[model samples]
Target: MIDRYVRPEMSRIWTEEATFARWVAIESLVARVQAEHGIIPAEAAETIAATPGPDISDVREAERTRDHEVLSFLAAWTKAMPDESARWVHHGLTSYDLVDTGLGLAMRDAVDLVLDAARELYRVLARRALEHWDTICVGRTHGIHAEPIRFGHKLATLAFAVDRSLTRLSAVRESVAVGTISGAVGTYATTTPAVEAEVLAGLGLTAEPAPTQVVCRDRHAELVAALAVLGASVEQLALEMRLLQRTEVAEVEEPRTSAYQGSSAMPHKRNPTTSERLCGLARLLRANVGAALEDVALWHERDLAHSSVERVVLPDSCNLAYYQVTAATELVDGLVVNTDRMAENLGATRGRIFSAQAYLQMTRNGVEREHAYRTVQQASLRSLQQGTQFADELGKDGIAFDESALDPKVFLQDEDVVRTRLHERLREHGTVTRP
Candidate 1:
């Protein structure tokens, strides 16, 4: 994780202390489950459950000599307990019995935090879309003016994209929220499936149907892939904000404070730093996908190939995802929309963006397609080159037509239908705080 971009809540999830603490939790639960089956004495289970987690520093020091984290963690934990309980600790369990279960729980919680941040962003987008449902602006394609569209319509497109992203994350959460205690080779030669089930249930995880030395890597890869998609969506919106805040466009700006500085040498620069940062971080999140996909294929049942790759990519990807969407929420929810600038830019090409409207209207009124194209193209070109109004050029040709069709809002005539559909969607997702 980038230290400056590290979000506090997400940062804590991947910490060594947190990881060690989860291991202790799993060990205690395993003991209790084993005790219920009479494999360990009930009093020993009680003592193990009651003991505080071992110091992370002690675990690290022990790991230096043992060269095994779970073993070192167990040594540090068991040394603090009486012989009777220490003997029962990790009895009939392998390292992954503690490690993978603990990891699943940590990933589940981290993804939950990401989901919460995404939901907040969804609500903000919905509310903003409703607020500006009829706010008209020029729509662009390939960085060129294409036609007129409501600014809110533009925002609603991303709102729906995020809705899909939310659905993907939700599904990936369940996929990765599995624990395996099937023992080293997954034959359950020593520990029974019943023990695995009960321990996983206590930890709020379900048993992986089958596992090798570790739970299947496909589940973990699915999670990273979803986060990468969400990161791309974040970049989509951030890039739009960056484009709109350009000096020539000046249609919107990310939230700015008085002390903000964009250029050190220039005084009049209010750059889209937040949006740019969001875009840049999203790239890093996407780059992790190849590493995650590579981790899906371990040698034979399992190997160390995937392990080292996951150690860096998984946590870092989650951290980057949470940071991007959370920061994007701040950028979006507080945007400074310059309506006057939007209107000015809409007309910057002298009504040429409405060429489609004229073309369609002509075609509908029984004009030849080629004739309509020629007439409208000529008028649009005349308006652009000679600085004359489109209607004036049309008037020179003596064509009687309703002037109302040329108005910007003519492009948003079906806004009511759009609002009704969006309202239903927002309500379905519980994001409808306002009508």
Candidate 2:
């Protein structure tokens, strides 16, 4: 991951130092497993385990000469260990065995960090949804007021989306939490399946059912796709913040710190900078998904095409996602919701926003469906043109109907019930876990 998107914990998991550390751990575990199976001397396994890990600088310097990361790492490792035990460092394993397994550990840790951020965001959204559950607002369709709806209802929908994204991320984590010790061509020519199982189990991973010199790229693709979807969810929330914070529809505003400055030239600007940043980063995440998909098709057993792409896409996507979730969480947590403005805006369209309720009430009062629809449509249009309420227009136009039944409050009468049900569902999904 680049420095710009890096969050300390997530960035640490993708560092060169971290990568080498994981490779060393995997090597140590493999040696112990081999020793247990009588494939290597116990003394050699003990010596290898006792050796200090290689410095990242030494590994990089070795790579400059070897032009192979695995060989370079192994060369550095041999230099650190006793001469006799050095030969047993990577005895029967192929490069992909260590590389892919180490990659799995790194990805698992990164995903865990992202999941923590997502859970926190989910809780923030759920709490805000409950807080605004009964606050009425105009529901818009085609950018025009359509009817009355609780603002909390809009937020509840977003909360449910966050929950679903978390579920998908958990599934993706399981898919990526696999390791393979199968040798060249996945034949296990020298290493045994038992050794692979034992080593992976010790690392909190499952053995890949099958591999082709590398773990299947489909797993990697799924991981990136999941992160892309998560990014899209965050972007959806940020986009809503941008829209609601618009000058004409100032129903919400992102937090502005004491030191915050929205613009250099404008004096009154309070731009949605954080929300816009999240939206832009989401586009990059989606683009990475395409690259991950392309990585799925490698020539025969494997190729280097997927390797270089994974180096960029995996860490970058994870880091971007983690940052987006945290940024969105802060935006939501400190959001300034203008409930008074929401109420005022709901009336901006006059009473035409309640036309559907009036139409339905007319039908229930024995008016034919078509007749009621036309009546309400005419009254609604007149209300707009004459700057009158829909109910008053209906009375003036001689459209006989029960005025009390067409009350706008009737549209939101069941709001409490709906909110209770939504809250119950969110509770059932459980509380967010902090990392």
Candidate 3:
């Protein structure tokens, strides 16, 4: 994640301190649940609840020597409690019972950050889209001029895409919010389903109906995939901004601070560094999603194979995505839209862009479809090569149709279609509401 986009809260969430805290929360909840099941004395549960978390110093040192985080945390936490009651702390559960459940908590917290970032982005996009509702720019297809489209329409389209991204994030949260306290191998060999229920309830999560060793890797895989998708959304916006910042387009640009340098040698260069970095990070997210997909195919009911990959992919994917969305919000919010440049570029190709509309109009009149297409194409080609106005060129291409039938003024005009359509859409999306 780029420094500019990395939120402090998101960074802290993925830190070792936060990870261990979640482990402690899960441990405390499990103890409380066990008490309800009568598996442990009420006083024992209370002591476990009041117990301080793992010694930060020892846990950090243990991570180095033990090469196992969850075990090290449990060791420190248990040591902090009196021996008699501490025995019931992790009773019946394997390391994953706490690890996977804790992972759920961490993921849920991380997702909340991402959702906030997305909503922020949506607000920026909606505002910017409406702000530029009437700002016109030449739309492109296959990197060539197509026709004029309001800049706000482009923003609103992105706003709609942002909504989809937010919806996906919400769904992924629900799917990944489940925790399990089921014993090793998921047989509940030492713990009862009631205990699992109580623990998850206490933790503000639902008990997984069933789990094998770890909360099924499939759930984690889904979350990783969703994060990757959200990253792609950021990339999509960034990619467009990159295109807009092109020297040829110069229709829009990402914000560049006075302290920021685009190039050391080229002093005049105001590069789209944020957008470029976003594109690069988006690729990493995509690769991580692939790694997550591979995690779905673990060796049997469980294997440590997925463990090592999850450690790297989960934190990195979430952090990177959070950074991407946050950066994207800033980028969109401060984007400089050059309406004059948009207008200038829109007619860069003269009247050729309206050729298709011209052809359609001529066809609607008495002209045959093939004949009309040829007529418009010839004039469009001449207008391009000879630097002639498309309407004039078409007028010079005298044909068997009424002179009035070939009038380009009616067909060439952009009119209010783009603006009207966008206004209806913006109202439908409820983006006009005051922020």
Candidate 4:
């Protein structure tokens, strides 16, 4: 992960020093397991275990001559051990045996961080949604007023999306948390399956059912795809915030700092910069998914093609995902919702937003669906163009419907019922405070 996208906790997991630490841990475990099976001398295994892990600087220097990272890492590890036991450092194992297994460990830790951030965001959204459960707002379709809905209902939808992303991250973590030690061609020709199982078990991972030098790229692709979907969910919420923060809409605003500036030239601007940043980062995640998918196919028996790509996409995607979830949580937590503005915007359409309700009422009264739709549509159009109330237009057109039943209050009552149902659904996932 680069410094630009790195958060402290996630950065620690992907650092060069940390990467070498995982590699050494895997090598030590493999040596211990080999000793248990009598493949290596017990004294050698003890020496390897007692040896301090090699420094990354030593490994890099060794790589200059070895030209193979795993061999270089082994050379560094052997250099740290007693001369008699050094040869047992990476006995009977291929380069990927350590590299892929260590990668699994790193990926598992990274995904766990992302999952925690996602869950926090989910809870924040749920609480905020409940806070605005009864706050009325006009729902829009095609960027035009369509009907009435509670502001909390829109927020509840975002909360559920975050919940789904959390679920995916959990599942992907399991998929990518597997390790493999099946020799060069994964045939166990030089090393036994029991050694692989024992070493992986010691490392808190399960052996890949079948591997060919490296763990299958499909598992990696699944992980990246999950992150991509998670990113999309984050982008969805940010996009909604961007729309709500528009000057004409003004239904919501990102929390402003006294020193915050939206632009250098404009004095009164308070833009949704965080939300826009999240939106832009989401595109990178989606694009990485394509590269991950492309990595799924390699030149038979595994090749280095996927290695170089995973080196970039895996850490970068996880780091960006962690940052996005945390930032979005902050955005939602401190969001300033303008209920007055929501109410004002709801009335901006002069009751034309109630056309759907009116249409439904006409159908309930035995009017044909098409006829009722046309009647309400025409009334709504006239109300908007002429700047008149839809109810008054309906009366002037001599449509025989109950004027009292067309009240906005009636629409609000129905919205309350819908909001209540949505709140109940949210409660199934987390606590929802009732008003």
Best by lDDT: 1
Judging by TM-score against the true structure, name the best candidate: 1
Model 3 / residue 227 / CA error / Å? 1.4
Tens-digit lDDT string for candidate 4 (1-435): 557766899978888889888887888788888988999999998898888877888889999998998788788878767788998778898888888899899989999999989988888887887788778788888888877777888988898888888888888988999999999889999899999988898888888898888898888999999999999999999999999999999999998788898889998888999999999999999999999999999898988888889889998998899998999999999999999998898789887777777788889988899998999889988998999998888877777657666455676665566556556755765665564
Clashing pairs in 4: none
lDDT of 2 by residue, 1-435 (tens): 567766898888988889988988999989999999999999999998888788988989999999998999999888977788999999899999999999899889888999989888888888888888778787888778888788888887787788888899899999999889998888899899989989999999987887889999899999999999999999999998899899999999999889988889997899999889999999999999999999999999998999889999999999999988998999999999999998899878777877777788778888899998998999888889989887788887676657665455677776677667666766666853221
Error of 2 at 304 (Å): 1.5
Per-candidate local distance difference test = 0.88, 0.87, 0.80, 0.86
Q: lDDT by residue for model 3 over 226-311, one digit each (tens)?
A: 88888887888899999999998899988878798778899889899989989988898899988888888866668888877988
Better of 2 and 4 by TM-score: 2
Stretches of candidate 1 above 4 Å error? 433-435
Give candidate 2 misplaced runs (Cα > 4 Å).
Answer: 400-408, 432-435
Which candidate, 1 or 2, has the higher lDDT?
A: 1
Give the Å error, residue 299, model 4: 1.7
Q: What is the lDDT of residue 19 in candidate 3?
A: 78
Model 2, residue 180: distance off in Å is 0.6
Using lDDT as the measure, name the better of candidate 1 and candidate 3: 1
Query: Which of the predicted structures, 3 or 4, would earn the higher TM-score when compared with the native?
Result: 4
TM-scores for all predictions: 0.97, 0.95, 0.91, 0.94
